[model samples]
Target: MQIPAGPLLQTINSPEDLKKVPKEKLHQVCDELRQYIIDVVSVHGGHFAASLGVVELTVALHYIYNTPYDQLVWDVGHQAYGHKILTGRRDNFISNRKYKGLSGFPKRSESEYDSFGVGHSSTSISAALGMAMAAKYKGETDRKAVAVIGDGAMTAGMAFEALNHAGVADTDMLVILNDNCMSIDPNVGALKEYLTDITTSQTYNKLRDDVWKMLGKLPVGKNFTREMASKLEAGIKGMVTRSSNLFEALNMRYFGPIDGHNITKLVDTLKDLRNIPGPKLLHIVTVKGKGYELAEKDQTKWHAPGLFDKITGEIYKKKFDLPQPPKYQDVFGHTILELAEKNEKVMGITPAMPSGSSLNIMMKAMPHRAIDVGIAEQHAVTLSAGMATQGLKVFCNIYSSFMQRAYDQAVHDAAIQKLPVIFCLDRAGLVGEDGPTHHGAYDVPYFRCIPNMIISAPMNEAELRNLMYTAQLDSTNLPFVIRYPRGEGVMPEWRRPLEEIKLGTGRRLREGKDVAILSFGHPGNFAAAAIRELRAEGIEPAHYDMRFAKPLDEALLHEALLQYEKIITVEDGTVVGGFGSAVAEFMALHGYKNDLKILGIPDRIVEHGTLKELHRECGYDAQAIADAVRQMRKQPVSEMTIPA
Candidate 1:
């Protein structure tokens, strides 16, 4: 059953409808909006906490600014659910993050209200500034561009770079600093401390609030207060706290440290700020999970807590008696702790994903060694290289998609110098629901061509353990990349002793004469399932787990080509310049012209869906593998023979 939006929210179909509601009644509207989000997310399951944090801000922005004309860019966009709901998508909001349904984040194609599409963090300021500059160029001085970025996102180098550029360029832009003091995990480093110091200054907040209150207390209210009481504020505040010189130093007028949930105050502040000229900053403090007690208590865990009971706030979960297979990330977290415990040189680094990547496990065990670098990917990579130069073994764990940010650092500092930086790339394939920007499709192809880089993907938990073990061996020197997928691993007995795997070698699972299927990473498990079905049809094709994409196992590949009539290479990465492309290149170079088929992500963008659905669409699922083999066998191509 579909839940109805509250009376105030029901009247709102667009921002135009939102503006019709009296300013005094906006709090009721925010309440309705927040409930609607909880109701829908309780059933449909999408990002929860971030959107909940910005309910009042979303309402205030739409109510104050002329959206679709005055641009609004949401940084990272996880918090844009409320923005989406207010902008004619309320009816379809329940379909958020579902396959072929409403996208979880703001999308330009989805709505005119979404001025810029966003998924990755720290792009909003730049995007909004560009729009602001474009509007100025077009002589539309009345229009405004606002970027609502979290304090966590503000820690990124891109955000600072944009601030530096925008400050000098003098773009008419507003940046909303949503300080919740958390991003997936509790934020780390100097910026976090700085933001915390501002928010925690009891004297500063009380003085600022009292000044605004005193302005209202004057018989003439704010205008009169600004005229006369401004001197008093300057006099008192100067004695108490250091001024907010941070945003001002970047040449943007900063106004805030205000309560985010106060809809009336938000509206009033926004109304005032809209009239201001040049770049401006509004620092609004919000709790990550404001309305809900459970999420507020444990914000990081609730960031994207799957499906949950809305009323009780209990996550819907299955109880299992049998030991469940650990997620690839958990295995990594546990393995790293074990490795660091044994090897004194082992150190871990992550770019603000201590909890998400499970590096928190190692950080807990060895706080000094495991470092959280606070949304700075390029810095994380270079820091690892610097550490590696000092003969320390560094496991630089980063999301595969996020590595796109630090590619240059990886090439110059790690690969070129042959630093033994163990790059454990989690989420290396289709990351379902988060969509194209978050997909780990490009990492394999992007890094494979880099010299002195060893690219390896494990087929299961056991192989992943072995690969991590093998990479950390004292003999290892070159930079190594271990790519793995998102979900649970197949091996329940994954806690076995870590054994070193021979580099550039593959293990054959089955033997056949007709065709040989080569697979890399977790996709080999899919191939194994297909092999069983093929055998049931008396189609016994051979299977080989090609562990490494960089150093192609020419000996094993030659062995397969000599035995089989055809060859098929499958990977979860892109077909263009990926693992499959590497295989094709090697086959052509060696003059082994046996009929070859490459299967992977097609050379186009794939939208959000379940992992299995995406795999099937990309034609690498078990059924797709079976169909490919059957089709290849039916073709009138002769068996490939080695040029002996």
Candidate 2:
């Protein structure tokens, strides 16, 4: 079905073209843009509500500014769909988040208008400040830099750190706070409350507005100079808002708690702010899913409601014939709640990803015990460590890619202290469609080298449950990591009785004579499928599920090594310093000469695509694993000997 854009939207091929449109027609453009987004995303899936919320702002920014020249940096990229469409990507918008198609986020390589690439939150201010500083250094006085950041993004410490620096840097830049009070989930923390007070305070707004009008009416002669007018306005703002004016305190001029959905207001505001000298901020209040009635009501559910019916608002789902296997995240969610019930010590924590990580299951049932720590990964880790000191079992669930931000905290606060914090790493492998920034490829390698860290991966739902059970037991002392993939696990009947898995151990799934295949995590299922395929070819290979990456199961390694001379290691993470590398290091340490092949994500940036596509591209899918086994069968196996 061809979804036609609004007549006005079709005419806008670029920001230059947008500037050509009459200012009176921008509201129509915003409406058309919002409807077009709904039409396209309802068929071709990507992030939904965020872009819808920013439609007016997107149109206004392009219409008012000389973009590409006046750079606009969108924080988190969820709101950049309209920006992309206006800036020469309108026709290809249907390919958003598809394999070899448009990226879901704002990528500099994708277009000149995308001033900076962003996927992770709270980075726009720093990036825009850098651009502003560069422009200043080059004496480009006419160039302007604007960072459009959400209130949810403002919760991160990095955002404040950038604000602290940009305030004193004296660079000419604008930070537009899109405060819809959301970041995938509803915004939390003191900042949310502070922004709320600023938005809702009628007394302050009235005083400020009255003073602005009074100043405008004042004479511009020697009696009331422009500088005098500016000083008067500053004094009134500081007095009216009192200590609540955070941006003013930071030495940046503050403007607005205005309706972001007002196209004309946004256009006028941006035009005026473009000429304002030094640092400044504009606070715009808009609904997250503006213009879409259903999306407006439930912002979180519509955040990325993949492939919905735009008319009926029915989200599409694969109709399974029977009960399907649960997602790894759901299993984690339910399991953590069960663990919390059985053990009073267990508490849950996630950094603004309760829904994504499935911690909302626990948070709903056990509100006091579970916490959503608003986009602060480092703080989440350290907070978990603090709870551990009180003998509480903390399940700090975070996305694999997001965990990178908390590495220092994990090392210093948890690992060094030997705090038994259970880190449930969701989306641990090639998370389809989200692309490079979101892949969970490095956790295995990065955490393996940390002292006292027990890094493990589960082959399926049962193992995941068992691992969770074992990690929370009184016997387990060190920091534990349970990394799993993005989507569904293999077992449909996943609700199994929990059992304690032994630490630093592995189980041989199959016994063979010709070769051995050792796998870590959910990739073990791929290995199983490959083994089934190879069996028909008479290639009898042994299979072992090596559960732990940090603590090598020497007994299992010895058993496999003593029996087979040809070995293959598979994982869902980067091959370098990953599970395969750990196995290789063990072999080298024991002086075992085996013809080995390492198969997993390669040491490179894998782009956005389906899991199957990325897995095949990375050469670790079932077919790839089968091919590796077949290739090894043709070669003569080197004789293996144990070290004296």
Candidate 3:
């Protein structure tokens, strides 16, 4: 992709510069902005189509409203790339999602334009309303707060919760419902455009003002004219567009189903909405990947295609030096498809991550069995539990970070009920580039305290399959969790014949008498590499792949404690309450005193980078583990230090 020759866009460093541009020339500016985004993202590889989808909306909002003061809170932040670019990050946008660079999502610390830091979806409405209510409390009655939420994000319960409050508060705020996929009504045509112009005209405005004044006078009667005025507005809106009972029933003044791409119409609507106040919801219909033809056709795949040619729209084929193993998500997708073929009770569920989790394969193969539950994680968890009660083996796939949203449901609905819902947690460790909010760093520790839960992390693709297979057996009654990392599995030929790994058990990969290193999940693979280096130095260390974090291979751990008398536990998650802490509790309970050290992510947030970089920072990389073992052996365990 060639750099966009954005003459107008080049001069506009910030929204302040955007305000200086003539309203009539905004369309050309928008075209240049969209192309600029394409040029940068095609090379840099951040969120692609989402930013493309909301170009005109972003332009119109910034052009119409006074941002950094009026405060436009973007939902999810993927669609806010245009907002970021217009708000003075355009020149530095190439470094987006890079290590210690600009965050992919909206971050409050990054810029003042980002009023609310957003990474998780559907929090925009709640955050915006809080700002609105705060503005009201501080007596800034004219301050405007707007939430630009996607139709996909609206499926979450939190969005509705905020709407429910905003509707009743009668606060002067706007909720822009960005309907990019599903349409409440067709885009406003020429006829609707004429009606909108007439409604905004001087003669029509004077007539409406006269009618409102007369109604105010009739308000001498108790609750009469106020009710009549609402009915009048509803009746008028019913003829103009589809009457949205959802937003309207909550007492929000509903106005739209407008053409989001039509910059003239968007500017007019937003300009009019500024004066007409009190909880208004303007539903604008937009096409995802509007300008880019290829992206518009396949919005989902193009949502975050790593690196692609801007002109041809072809994803750059990664040339690996060696044969590449499939992603862990593909392993889960294929394994579940295979399992479903064998068992009639097998079913799949994902909360808006069918494709991301690779469950879309099963979705295509068995549409009846597999379900895409939208962005409702809490509902997805309880729904799986409900399915489990009916004797169905539900394989509910969710990202580890997303599962944090449904933690209560996992505990109350699944664990407390002792339901056999197989939770397939993808991205169970440091997910690079998405940054802190997206890192899968807390699943093991979070679920450890819950009863009737079995948390297992597989070291490779084969263990993932066997563990998944083991969870489906008729004997399995408890809620099972199988967590694996984001990238490719270590094993290339991993789909071996299904084997049942015994519960509460672990397997030894290396043999030693001096030091025993027990590792869990994908981090155990690092220990494998570390052991190879140790052996080259004629110092062999026992390496145990402790598969289950919950039922910690008591018999194997007991034997290791007696034989080696020195131990270390490593995991991909935090050390505070994670796998290492579980082993520590076991030692405390049984009174087995061995010189022990724990190595994993420390008690702080790990930033975005490659897994190798992050693993080294957390002191669980191959070299770090080798160094730790040598230090533990040479010095006392207490004297040995691990990088935080």
Question: Best-fitting candidate, measured by TM-score?
Answer: 2
| Candidate structures ordered by lDDT, highest first | 2, 1, 3
lDDT per residue as tens, model 3, 316-401 = 98788977788999999999999999999999999888888999899899999999877889999999999999999999999999
What is candidate 1's lDDT per residue for 56-162, written digit by digit as tens? 99999999999989999999899999999999999898778878888888998889999899998999999998998898899998999999999889889999999
What are the Cα lDDT values of the candidates?
0.90, 0.92, 0.85
The window of 10 residues in a row where model 2 has the poorest summed lDDT is 236-245
lDDT of 2 by residue, 165-283 (tens): 99999899999999999999998899898888888888778877888788888789978898887787677666766433688778877888889999998999888988889999999
Q: What is the alpha-carbon RMSD of candidate 2 to the true structure?
A: 1.3
The TM-score of candidate 1 is 0.96
Provide backbone clash counts, one per model.
0, 0, 0
TM-score of predicted structure 2 = 0.98
Give candidate 1 misplaced runs (Cα > 4 Å): 210-239, 638-641
Pick out the ten consecutive residues of candidate 1 with the lowest summed lDDT: 234-243
**Colliding pairs, model 1:** none
